[model samples]
Target: MPPKSNDIEAGQAIKRLPSNAELVPHAGKITMDEPAYFGKGIIKDLKTTVGTHWRQEMTNFNQKTVAVSMLMFITVIAPTLAFGASYSTATESHIGAIETILATAWIGCAYSFIGGMPLCIIGSTGPVLAFTTVLYDMSKNMDIPFYTFYAWVSVWMLIYAFLCSFFDLTRFVRLATRFTDDIFAFLIVSIFVIKAIGDPFGGVDGILFPFDPNHKTHQNQDADYDFLQVALLGVILGFGTTWLIFYLRSFKNSSFFCSDTMRSSIHDFSVTFSVLIWTIVSKVIFKDVEVASLNVPDQFEPTYQCCDDACTMFFPKECPDQAERAGVRSWFADMADTNGKGWVPIAAAGPAVLAFFLLYLDNGITWHLIMHKSNNVHHGEAYNYDLLLSGCFNFVNGLLGLPWLVATTVPCIVHLNSLAEKDKDGNILHVQETRLTMLFSHMCVGFSILALDLLKLLPLPVLNGVFLFMGVSALPGIQFWNRFLLFFQQPSKYPETPYTKYMDKGRIHLFTIIELFFFAMVFVVQNIKAVAVVFPMMTFFCIPARTHLLPRIFEGWELVLLDGDIFEIQEWIDRKTDSVAEYEASLRGDLSEYEDDATQ
Candidate 1:
């Protein structure tokens, strides 16, 4: 979904003197204090937006939808594909690119039609991959079937998601500041970077245990990969893909792109185009190397197996690597086989509760980032409602034995920027906001399930490169990263962002120091096996630190300048600038301080 087009222009537009015709922002058509859902003004928000976006799409269905759909088709599929491959490989589960595409396309389509925040792009993420992977390992050791245990976990996740909405825990999400958002954002992006650098298979883990293709022997779970022979190709393809992505993103501003339509098209299809070009290049240049390819099959098939002869045990060590996924049919598998006398599902609830907390934090903070005032998304926040809807979707995913989905950070950011139309000044004027683009983009993914073989043609290294590009693109926006740059940047030449405008340079340094500490803590916790399952809980720790500890350390104005919404910062800037002008007037002896004011 497109963000509000005026975001980039907001700072400048608000500076001009107020007039009747100058654009004025409306504080959403409906407002409700979310106190345990007591306000209950949900219908009011829904009614106001019923046809606003739909009408825009109807008016230019052929032109805009085609461009966005094409662009989204290219962008959406690769991540889901890559995520599917990674998740399945790590967990030894039946999840594949096709299933991932199915879920993403299906759930995203439903969300677009009715979900409140269209800007939030949904997909499986690094945390959930880690979450599910750990669960699978646990169930296997305990002799519980993975999917059966997964089904129970899914039930608990949905229940908790609904519980979160019902009790108004949704309100806590609003309290997230840049302090917490950057920490999680950094964590998500780094998964890509670390994965690519550490292993040819992807992720921070440096090894992959390949199995015998002939299916003749027991594959060692600890088998180590020697990527050094093909590592050079990985580096070349990865960096090349990354460069193409960065180049294409900035290409919209290039003179060569010329017309708006051309630039828009390039911007929309940049990721897909970059991936395709490099993939072809890798095939031609590295044909001699036995590099990894995507695990996508040519047609729909079961990623897992189910049979009367199947061993009912969770992950039998006697079973070969492929045989673990060889038990179930591609379409459906019942949980009754592994629920372990109805008590396992009950016990699974404890871990399910933990997973739901992470899901809640990740989803909430992502929504916070996308809907940040600076992003200029004008729609009302439906925290409670969206949470409930996600629970329904996840419950369905559990039943189908598919990967659970969450709001992916980079994709959502990319989606918003693509749908925007910038002015000569390069600030967004307005977005061509419509659900059709999202709907159509996802529809293409659903249709592409049968074409998985085509995706396999591209070497897996190229996909790794795409991941690197995604990680790098997300780095600049992080507050801690920007703040860290100050150590090398000369003080007088600091960038004129809100933090610089209203925060003392030294205080900003201290603020980032505190944030950096949080980032390091979460990173350590997520990577450490003992604490990884509770990573989201560790991430949630930032909220209380900001809410309680930070206030005691920094003054109210400093916190506002550093962490407040755009309007709040602008208000502080206005007052401080006025005070500075008055001080300058006193130095010039133009007027007494006792007077109302004098020109600077």
Candidate 2:
């Protein structure tokens, strides 16, 4: 491919080469540019085709595999912290930590890879945790071991998720829209706000129904005063520590100031390290301050020790001498050790059937929208096969004691589109050429959960703060409505429009009215707990409008090119049909009338 030595010296290498005139050979041959040669490339692609296909298959398989590790970490860590803190106000259980971490990691693995919109990192959620705590309380009273109840709940959740997946339940999610997502996001954010923010300001007093208000502690002091003081101190510490950490992290990377990486690293370290220092300092200061610290046991062990630190407490090994072994016997019955005394197996037919239908509708809706937004994975809006696989994944998650898992999020599509090169016209120049950053981000999350210790050190309040920040950030995406309103208002910018040109001069009227109403309703519903109880659950209604109605309606409008206002409906009729045909028929009737008049 290199230029001939003569051409190199001549400095005219770019000129087209001329063919040599040969007397003895059939020399009517064409020459091609050296740069145009693609023979080797074609062969190379062919050689790697099978390998490429196999790797893609493997990556998908690993989604579920990696999820297990993530699930284990949460299952062990979250519950241990929650339970140990709750049970003995002063004591912490290391056993609960290990169990929670493992269970959560297992569930996360299934959720991350297999479910509809497989982007939501599912593990131990707050509601589920609350549910578990209730079960634990009930089990203790009934002489049933807590883990047995947890196992039962897990079984139920798995069954629920599986059934949901079976019926392609995610389809219901398609009904939601951006507005709906926003509302749901708002609701979730409100719950966090109420717990973390509102609880400090007399909000907890409203819910104190069955409490022993005047109960004296074992120390002959009012428990309420101690509880209140400790709660207040905790609230202050949690919020202050969370804020400091966030600010530190925010300042770590300075793009504008050109700060050095060393400085950034120090900032990052200080945030977490300072929080750790404060936690220790707070404990030392409060040694006699009556506030709780971490309740971990003296030693950590890996054995499946059920009673003390385990995910759920188990049966007492021994009973008192004369007290008829009711507790022990009941524990056995709770574990279903005897002839079906402990376990009441429900027919999978009743609840399982209900769960399956719910999951199918839910999964179908979420997946379809995810695919559309992601752009890279267009299974099409009407795809049945993709729905089938999604259902199958959820069904499997249920069997593994996971909460009903569904499609992961579709943010990867946005990441893929970001990397895709664009032409002058902004169309994608090529496909599958860039790394899917968000999907890879999901992988990173899975890996972190697997690593265990990395995430464990981060304070829960900081995480909650981050969640709050993200929820706030999502608010701006809704501002596009303002832009749409601006466009609608400027009809002169768009010359041809029946509604805009004639009906209204300013879209400000409609846009402001609609947006204000939506905002008021959303804010009121989210803030007032009592109103939420009274209203129809709005989240489900929000989903489909986001996914299905808007897209389909837009498609319909584009297909028909409908151009008419309320006043111009009759004008849209065909002129030929109305004028020529109808005119002829009218003429015949007029002639008959005229002939009768002439005869008269």
Candidate 3:
């Protein structure tokens, strides 16, 4: 007969590899030693990363890759046009839709080919948008050409990026814990959620519900009813798209589905299918109703018209009046168009410092999240090299007066999740890591300039629904979000993870509360324009807070249970059990010796 399960477990030994601290004995402690400088291991790092890069892409040629490419293309386009419009408003048309789309296409294509992580989709972000707006305002106040000043700032930031990379400063990202990462990820998710739902209190300027009183169709006798009709259709399209996507994605697990392969295919192309379904609904069923669509540029030209007679070359029949085109600029920024002040270039470094920190934290944190263990990404990291490349791209963009782009969190997460092969329990088995999706998607964005009218058929609310799905879908993976939901649940019914099993409910709540406090601080600071420039600094403070402050409140073992990964928690438990076993053996030996002495 076989041994009983419990009896066998009692005789089994726990196995674990030596941790970094155990191997080095001084791994996490501060010490004075010869540091790795001048990109000491960057060459070898690149060699390892690049060796498998092309081979990985070649092996990923399948239907899933094509499906993901379509999904990402749609995902990237909405935000590009939306942010481009916002940038034009903020900078008074110095940069606009065409420039943004072009930047997204060119930089995205280049990075997909050579970036350290091809899965990370690079694009413009909210913080970079805010920083550029502030820089433009400063240039205006100081009586300098905004583009020229922006160029100098970009140059200084480029210098700073190379210097930091050469000195291996990106190694500091290892100090960031899940505490910091979750907060930032939650903040981004919140933005997407809010934008997708639109204003509930009857706002006309919402992304999906752009109800203008002066629109051409609104001048009819039944304007009020027409507004209501449009609003109702917008709601249907937006929420309907979201519902269809969720239902189709969940169909894979349903018993009534056609076949396993058929259901999986439906799940794989859920987003694309949802978009198509709703778009057809909008176009065919409500053909006469007016709804908001994408605002694509009619031609691939600079958004800001020329200020001088050069306008006649491009638009001889309908050139703008001289007075209307006074401060307009061309595609290339004039470096010498400054206020004739020699100190301007040096002064530009001030804003460049803020830009550097913003890019460093934003890029580093997003990369950290991508390379996170939960994502199951096998590609090695190249933080320093990626940072250097971003700086170079920004320098070129500044020269051409285009918006600076970074590793946008939402799109990166969406891209990663789309390519991930998950089990029935929703665990990531493997990510279809490849370059083809981003390359093909971005190439389509570049080609979109020719088919602007075709793109106009995609209603804004359908895209908003996609945004809502992306944001809501990301929430399940976040531990913080899971814990926050526990605030309303009974303690007895809580899910039995290592933390919930070993740690007290009160202690878990306390740790979550502290994280919430920091998250609130970052969120508040990010929203306020006056303090937004220090947003990166605010996030950076989380590293020190997690490292220095939390250790005082909780015991080391408890922290491992609460904040550590699965392997970490297991190792801690194994170490404690080993120590207890050794103590028992020592006590037994002492007992035997004492018995011998007594007998003698």
Measured against the true structure, the TM-scores of the candidates, in listed sequence, are 0.80, 0.46, 0.86
Write model 1 residue lDDT over 1-600, tens digit each, in one string: 422323233232112222211122331111234475533433443454543454554355656567667656655776787777777677664566667877898998998788767767888776788888888888878888777888889999998887777767777777777778888888877766777555432323211212223211122322453345455566677677778877887767787756977876776667778877877777776666556666565566545544325635234443555444435453554667764566887888998987898789878888877777766667556677777778889889888878889888877766666677666544456666667777888887887775666767867666666667667766776667888899889988988776786567888999889988998898888777666767778888898898879877877677766776677667666666655565444444443443643343
Cα lDDT, model 2, residue 102: 35
Worst 10-residue lDDT window for candidate 1 reads 21-30
Ordered from best to worst lDDT, the candidate numbers read 3, 1, 2
- Per-residue alpha-carbon lDDT of model 3 for 1-600, expressed as tens digits? 533323323344222333323432222222232445888645645766666576777467888888899999999998999888888878877789888999999998998778878888989888899899999899989988888999999999999999988888887876676778888888889878878886442231344444555543345545345776787788899989899999999987888666898888898899999999999999999988777787777778787765554332222114544345533357787777676888988999998998988889889998887777767888787788888899999999999999999999989988999999887656688998898899999999999988989989999889999999999988887888989988999999998777787678998999999999999999889777787767878888988888889887876666666666556667766665554554443433333443365599
Sort by TM-score, best first: what order? 3, 1, 2
The collision pairs in model 1 are: 5-430, 5-431, 195-203, 302-330, 305-326, 305-327, 305-328, 306-327, 306-328
Identify the runs in model 1 with alpha carbons over 4 angstroms from their true place: 1-75, 89-91, 94-98, 137-144, 199-230, 284-290, 307-327, 330-340, 421-429, 582-600
lDDT of 1 at 529: 62
Cα lDDT for residue 93, candidate 3: 75
Model 3 poorest ten-residue lDDT run: 24-33
- TM-score leader: 3
Q: Model 2, stretches more than 4 Å misplaced?
A: 1-99, 110-118, 126-169, 198-236, 245-348, 353-538, 543-600
- Cα shift from native, residue 209, model 1 (Å): 14
